[model samples]
Target: MAGLDDYQFFSTLREKDNPFWQRTSDDRDRLEDPMDHYRRPTEFPEDLRNPAHGTPGPPPTKAPAPTPKFNELEGQKVNDVQMEKYGELSINIVSLCAENLLSHPFIVVRRQCQVNISSHRYHVLPITIVPALLHIQSCQGFSAFWKGLGSVLTIKGITLGLEDCLSKFTPWPKDISPHSSIKTIGQHLLLKSSALALITPFYSASLVETVQSEIASEKPGVFDVFKEGLTRLLSFTQPQTGRMLPVWLLVVPTVTHGVLQYILGNSVSTLTSKLLRRLHRNDQHRQGAVSKDSGSFLDASIRLQSAFIGHMAADVILYPLETILNRLHMQGTRTIIDSLDVGYEVKPILTRYEGFFDCLNTTIQDEGFFGLFKGFGALCIQYALYGAVLKFAQVIIQEVTLALVPPKPKPKIQDPVTPLAPSAPYTPSSIHPGISSLHTSPLPPPRTPYGASPATRRPLGYGSPGRRQDVDMRAELEKHKSSLALDD
Candidate 1:
């Protein structure tokens, strides 16, 4: 009897080791009858029933199931980001072109107004915006309004591209804190001002082109105008000796005006940011909510408004310097420019400025302090229309983009399905009495590696480790996509 009991106990232990009888802890607890284990022994082959009687081989090694090379969601996200960048770029380019095209007439009138020699001898009086526009229209025809537009666009494109390239290549100091607004602004100013200084010749040439009236009967092409402007800019001859003036004379005023303008704009922007922050904080306090930082919708609107205001303020404040710079640009190029008066008459600059300070002093002495802001009204109106048009266009573009490519729907969250039990003749509940409770009771919430609550835990292949893997995978996918696009 004792020997039989020992055999049964060993057989039960052996049964537990068999793969066929393998079950979760819950399944083992579901056994109602102790004899059930003994009854199940006859179901397996003789070799599996008693491992000691036969040698058990190692399980076959199978290759891990291939993980997907790319995730659709991740790819979509990458595409969306790229699309946004491209869309913004297109919008900016379009906006710039549109603004320049629509507002260029005002610019032409303003330039003419600025360079007009207010003298009794020349009969060139200080011209207002409307009269100047009308005079230019009548004398030079309406087409004269866009005279130097090509040069302006060319200069703008070069400046923007050069600045972008310079900023990318510029070596930032390691010690400078990213949070230090002043240092960052200074660094940006240095780079941009340097860029401006480098392109002073082009800028001066363009300004000169804008103010000069065409003498030839045929309208010149953009390239021809640009070439002629460059020639004129370099051909500045000293009145006394007829020797060409040095390039540095043009560089000084242009660089100074650019640097001062940038500084004033940045100062205004910083002040506006601080004021917005204060107002936001006060509003948050009133609403009894935690104040959000500067990335919200309200903050974006504030930033846009501040930038617009800053640019306007800077332009208004620096109008005198701009006027002086224009005069300096035209100093040696003693060309007959449109007076923007009633008659079909043109006049040459009467006063020759030695330098920026000389130009400023002479203008004040001869034309009064207000002479510096000759075309101020036209400038204000141009910018106002530009801002309104740009804002409207952006909205239209955004709406069109949405209509063309609707945003993807958010993925739905489904409840986790309990892992299915292996197929067998007996149900899991019949395997053991204690396991019966497992089928009837709700599953315990799964614990995350990060100790997150089940409700907050993301599904497999998302968040933390999975998200990192997805990012790496997405990078590889992006490379492949770009290569494919290039090939196409």
Candidate 2:
């Protein structure tokens, strides 16, 4: 009986080496009943009691199925998945554009108008306006007016046209509107009133170029002399950027200027009016009313204030463009802002600053918050002149074009010039290429070549007649020299 008990007990134990036994043990440990033939016990005590008494289970079990590993992927499925993801990505980009427009129109406008200020002046306003205003304002005087106007119109038309052309390419979402009423107002101001002020720089730079040429006969290129002069100018102030004039460092001066103008406008006028009233008190008591001239000083002060503020606002608006363009010109890239690299990779000339916040941060980091406004005085002067030149050029060009183009007569077919054989040699004419050189001829109208009407030549920039290179060079030298003197 004891031997039988031992056999039964041994049979109950699993063979440790058997794979079937191991898998069975794993299943049991994992609490998996593969057969599903019996209900689980309610308690551990009941399970223990039934462990020996449960009907003898089938001998162990085979091992669980091995997991398969596949080497090849379904190329078609993968392509489909990728395509789906690309569509999703497109949707996301569209959504982002829409959301961004609704939430941040200022950012869009900011990209359009970058305010440029120098490093030497801290007190002046550093805000920079657009370029169109300069073109408009430059038009003035006699034959020069229409030419200048035409130049400005051309530039403005080109810029706005470019913007419109690019709008279609912008991948904005369905819900987004990059433009806003506020932005439109800002744009108008920037394109017109603000832009006019910035034309001065072209004239100023031209002037400087002129001076440089005059001096070049006796000295090195104006650039070299300019570098030396710039260094000398910086000797009085610590320059943050190696070659830049410390002109941008005087923020206080700019502030003082603006403040002075503001005070001159509103406060001065009010004070003048009050004083004038005191003087007129006796007159009022005698005549029951003061004369219109009683507040003449105040009236003059008010008028002066409006003119000063208007001129100042209008003047400095495009200073940033001038500053940027000048810096670029000095560095040798005249037409475009960026280098040949990707947009983000292109470094701005005045990378000494990133933005308004960056400037303020640098000021605080290097010399406290006060340093942010450096060069305000120089900026005001720089911007005022910069805008003036740009405007002057536009005005001049329009005027010139108008003057040059003769009034068109109704088209009539007259005797057209008869062409000689193709093998015939051409002869040069004595007529000069410019409108200024054209003689007023009383002779019958010249025969049209190929029966084509004479095309009216439009004015070029600033309504100035196209002169010989030597003449242009002389003018440029004179202008440069004048600017250099002013800077000194």
Candidate 3:
């Protein structure tokens, strides 16, 4: 009986391992008795379950998905990941510092304006405002940093990746491969799509969220408050027809800015950058001649020169585009906050300016050519100084990075051939062992001139001596010198 029980236990164990039984078991585990679509644990209808016999509750809303994890240190091990994360953290912290330093001035000015400081001032003097615009708040700095981060990741980074892929996949002339025009168009598409997908949603939310209302209302003048409020009117997924102007601003103004930047800003910037770099190079060359340090503006002076010039020109000269863009965003909106008094009447601002071109034409016709540059003074204060600070901040960050992470000491480049001095002493390696061993004839020692003794041998400059009968080399040299002296 015990043997039989053992056999039964063994059989059960073997059955668990068997493919057929395993499949059966899996099927059994999966299988469940059929139930009603709206199944309840009590086996009752909603009407029955409810003591009041009320309607059923709607299905629970799905919670937002958990953020996905990525291999932050994807290169290798846990230690590697930690190192990479730390490096990235350091860079981000440095960038944050830069952003804060650069943008805080503008934020402070706006804050001052909010507080009704110098209330009557309509047109701020660029000189006076530039200094004020230099200050950045911690929050404002972080906002700018995050905004820029979003811009890069969603728009620029994606565009770069797409462009790289396209450049690789698409065949073209070797010289003009990954054509600039084509890439620019793609960039526009990517930028717009990115703006719509990423920026627009956040922007739309920020509009109705009442987050900036405090500052928006704090600015002096009822008209200015209204204008700011109108600018921040609600714009969700289904923005009203009149409210669609911000969309137009997002599309045309950005594209126009890009076009202008490419044509005017880039050319001037490049030209300026090149000139500055050339000058810097010249200065460095002079400095190197004088001192051994050879320190230019920055360690990577070329990059710094380009960044500063390009960024400065864009911020200062191209700021008018941003003003126009804002104006465009303001146009075509039907909703008006107007005066709080019921009796007060407000003029309809823009009936004809229903879209981008219309708004642009209207601005030009009504306000003159300089109308597009309405905020030019403010922009000069904001962008110009901000740009200077930002670029300088970048330089500072790079300098710090160089100091701490100190770029992999650039490989010591070996010269193609170090010219041997004419007076250099001949070594054993200088002698051609094969050539020397080939000849059994007892000639001058290896590397020594043939027919020349080591004591009287001329160094490298005077050509190799031909094999000859044993002779006094010094005597010959002395004789030649005498002959040359006599000739002179």
Candidate 4:
């Protein structure tokens, strides 16, 4: 009796009269509930309603939920990302310094070679790298090789750091597509070129400091040299009067070099990467299977090599311009440089140029086209050594850093498993004692059609159309009884 009452109570809870059931429009309007903010039209003042039935009121407003705050773990993750970026930046700077330090001698040799000219009096024709290096060693000693190294390092480091910092604030585009429009490419090139051009004065100063012969009697500090270079760069005095070329003259060449170098380097890198990928794919097809680790390592190697190759190619192509630029930097500075020796006598620049094209024309006419690339061999050797040293240093630093501070392992997440309830075993029962118990399996549950639910499976008398008829339990029991009696 209690079980029957409980069932009746639950069944009644689904009826329209139950308070828990969803209210209809008319039923809600008829009710007078203080808690319900959506009041009936009659309760409102006449001015608020239409002439007949009032228009439906707007839905009740909801307060927005508070935003979730970052927890400690989330904050830690963000910090880690920032730290990683800083770490990579530091590593690159360190590697750059190391590379420069190791290969600076070659730089000295190259600059000297570039500035050296063949005169009829000295007959210093066919100036080569080995001879030039030996001459510097004999005359200026080993220390002369790094004469302007401090200025170079300072300029390069500051420029690299400043550019990186500014890049964050700059509205430079990211992840540009290969088929990007001309406008986008122009914007990218313009922005990058401008950044480089802005630092042209400093670069010119560094170049002047580099090409100037070391003064033994009164050695100037790095900062002093740098300041002097700046002073000379901004002065408009002629070469014979002993003043460096004006900084403005180098702007066009610097910007042009920056833009062209960027374009050529990227183009070469892209082509190299594509070629490598094609070869890799062909090899993979033939080999059938390759380990992911090996493939990833291969990709890293390819990128590093491609970048190196691109930079080298750009440098090679632009060597003439660089040589001319170096010469221009030394144009007004009448310092006796050890590298420009003809018959063991130091020589300074005697020619003056009006502009970049004028300098280009003068250099070609005076020494032929090949003369512009005076120290090509030294440049190549310097770059090769720099690349090798930079890579080695980076690897060593990263390995040591990892050894000192290993990465923390990620936390494992295990989902909660829901254990299903055990189903009861099937047992048949006889409907009638008179009929001998004939074993028969239980019938399968009725099939529910697609999109059908318990509400739609109610008896036909229910208000809903397209509803199924409910099964009659009593009729099914009587059918079983009749079947058993027939067996008897």
Candidate 5:
């Protein structure tokens, strides 16, 4: 069969009709329309016939009533739709705060880091804004800040809910539930990667270097498709180039964060747990939230713990990479504002390193490896604050949201088959509502008119205390007759 020509084999197989391999004639194949819209059968089978009269019988003695689909349970629906919407609004606010707080450290470090003119040997000094002045920011900066927060609330928020559905498929072990560190990092990767992709335009707009870098370039590469694509995306906007952030630059940190945590999480948590357990031998420590787990705060959630510890640790150890990435991205990226006019201005904030390794090598050669750790302090605060706000808000909001949402009432399901119909109609009682309700007649007690009670006593001829004998009817009649004649 494998070697035979297609025509020869197919023809032979088609012509052959051995009984074992043959197919019976089908009325369906003869249909004028092979793809007939309807398929209901025209013939009736024997089993389908009614047992009572050799034909399909009517429905059973009592057919079950169909249960109607309804939005409400019983007679009541969810009480407050407005309250739910309000809570949703507050949730968005919280998300914005969390996202901004998380990214502040990176922003501060990047803002301080300097750049040179394209291909220049010397580094330009940074225009340092006083700590308090960081509060005042560019219009483009506000755009990026709000965009990141909105992305977290809408895109990341929805993604988290969908991710929670993964739990519904299986009740995985404690190591794999929503609590697992590896699993949680994976969640972050999914969440952040998507969020980054969604708001890339805004991030690009926020960073002014993109346009500036593109302008200062002697030759543009085919790889600069990112800026070109972003320009198309923001075609409707006034300006597109310098006001934008690079997608890869923004995504790299989140991607790195997840991977680094995945690699370092188990070891760090294990060592931390062992150390926490050695705190005291008191019996009170035997059982409690803080007894065994290691986290950001005492007895805090593992997510908070992982984010705070993992992010800070990664920042410090890999702070050079962090700085390098920031510099790589921030070089020639700036958004300018003058008077009431808003537009993007090309300004190279860092020009020494064009790529990852270039930045890494340059930083080491010029400023030593310590240069990477420039924003370590601010970055640490950012990570720590993010973890605190995250965990604290989660715990508080969980309770608050729970309070806002009404709990589901247990169903009042009735047994369908068990008939418990009342024999009599209800009669209102002449009594208080809290007291006796239906005025049912009280039953009479058991007793008899005879001396002996009916339960234990026997008939007259039986062995009872009082029994009747035969009456002397003839003797009583003669005596009655004589007495009557004398009286007459």
Candidate 6:
């Protein structure tokens, strides 16, 4: 008859570091087995036997009156489950075939080629290959039958989400400088370097110094054009270092996938229309919803067609890079983190550009047509969800940062005095806000000479008469020259 309090109190006195005491305190049920008092249910309860319980019983054994069967039954009976299973099987077979045909050596070569082409186009190496490989290894225990499928979706989702979020707040050209003199060319270059810097450390800082040093080398204006063009291209694809796929390979596939889908989608829609027509034609005695003042089957069919098209289109655009990006991350490159110390030689050989195509075509030839779409089925799901979330998050982060930090204002200049014709009617546009006309009448300029003629003038020193007017005119000319210089 030991009390629970007695055990706990005694355990604390044993010492804080005592393993036995700690275990006893941490798991009271384990130390004192409660299953010793276990019980099992044997019979039904009184409430269950009572007819008052809300349990449903068998239906009355009676026949219903006959009614005309709608042809909708035929439409509904088209065996959608079977169709779905067939589609899944087709996807599996196609992906397997593609993988088998595309040999490991070819894949490696294609991956290396992707690195080269992407690096050439972007002027920076995407070192995500290492991370991508690592990811594959870690997840390698999973069946190769569905290889790259999950990874592709994950990569797409993250990259798209990040790009979307970053785009909204820090929309291109994403200028980072606070200095007014460095606003246009300087800031643009900074952004480009910054994006690259994220992947390859210190690239932006080095680029800045390079530009400044090169300022003395060329017509400074030519460099400005270079900065602008490079900035725009880089902005088009703001690559994130941690994405599942390397950013370089993301472009061609996404665009191609989107286009192909649009073309195929239209065909599928036509097929659906023919199927719906057949169903409507088969049923005469059965009154359709349209005939009874309800919604038409045609409308439902079209909606379904539209949904199907949209789903397939989205999948096409986002699926290819899904596993590739993940593969990139798992096989991440150290080059990104150590970009500053490393000097990259930017060059693209013909071999680099053709390698990916060779691998792709070879895989198809060996593995059958399905090899081209390896990992696509799983990727479809992955891209749909991942792309959506990643895009949204990145956009939000950029927007929030920009909104919190607004730009500063610049300095202004003072306008000088000017002469105006009294006979000419001066319009509002002709007059400067800060500067007023100096009168040219016969009057001694200001001071003790009150009520003098307006045309009178002043002297430089006490003896030099009308000399101040000459000085004033020269000053005005210099100011005019300065203003003109700024405009040019």
Give all candidates' CA lDDT scores: 0.63, 0.35, 0.42, 0.62, 0.43, 0.35
Cα lDDT, model 1, residue 84: 57
lDDT of 4 at 209: 65
User: Clash number for model 3?
Assistant: 7
lDDT of 5 by residue, 20-39 (tens): 13333653365355544453
Candidate 2's C-alpha runs over 4 A off are 1-289, 292-301, 309-364, 375-488
How far residue 76's Cα lies from its native spot in candidate 5, in Å, is 27
Query: Best candidate per lDDT, number?
Result: 1
| TM-score of candidate 4 against the unseen true structure | 0.55
**Candidate 5 overall lDDT versus native:** 0.43
Provide the TM-score for each candidate, comma-separated: 0.56, 0.20, 0.39, 0.55, 0.36, 0.23
For candidate 2, lDDT tens digit of each residue in 25-51? 555676565544454222233335446
- Model 1, range 1-488, lDDT digits (tens) per residue? 22344344434543444323356465668746576657633345433644875767566477699987988688776666555555576566666575679889778777777888663222223234466567667766777878878888898897888887887788532223337778776777677777887677677667766777776324446676457545644544432323224457767778888888877886797788779778878888898986444323344445555766677788888888888878777666565676655435778766566777877888888878778877777787777887887677667766665565547868999999998685534222122332211111111223335877765764322333111221233443354455455556
Please give, for residues 37-82, the per-residue lDDT of candidate 4 as tens digits: 5653224443555545767555556769999986767666565555
Residue 388 displacement in candidate 1 (angstroms): 1.5
In angstroms, give how far residue 288 of model 5 lies from its true place: 12
Per-residue accuracy of model 3 over 1-488 as CA lDDT, tens digit each: 21334334333433443321133465467545465334532344444554565665666577699898765444233443344445445544544554455544343233223222112332344554433223322213324212222222233444455445545655421122224687666554454443343333233222222112222233223233333333444442335564445443355455566556645655665677668756767887887753444333333344444545565577557654654544444344432211111212222224434555765676567656655544245544655665565566556654654465423334579779986545333222222332221111112222444787765674332344333233444554465455455556
Q: On residues 1-488, what C-alpha lDDT tens digit does candidate 6 reach at each position?
A: 12234334333433333322134445556445465345222234334564666774555456577787776544433443343344444433433343333232223222322223223121112242334334433543223223223333333343345444444666434433334354564444443333332332121212222212111222224234334324434654443433223334433443344344433554555566566555665563365433432123234333344445454554455433422322222222212211111112222212112223544554445544443344343333333434344334334533543454343333467696685534422112122223333212122322425565544433332223222222354554454455455556
- Of 2 and 4, the candidate ahead on lDDT is 4
What TM-score should be assigned to candidate 2? 0.20
What residue runs in model 3 are displaced by over 4 Å at the alpha carbon?
A: 1-101, 104-124, 127-212, 215-243, 246-250, 262-266, 287-301, 331-352, 365-368, 387-488
Give the range of the ten consecutive residues with the poorest summed lDDT in model 6: 334-343
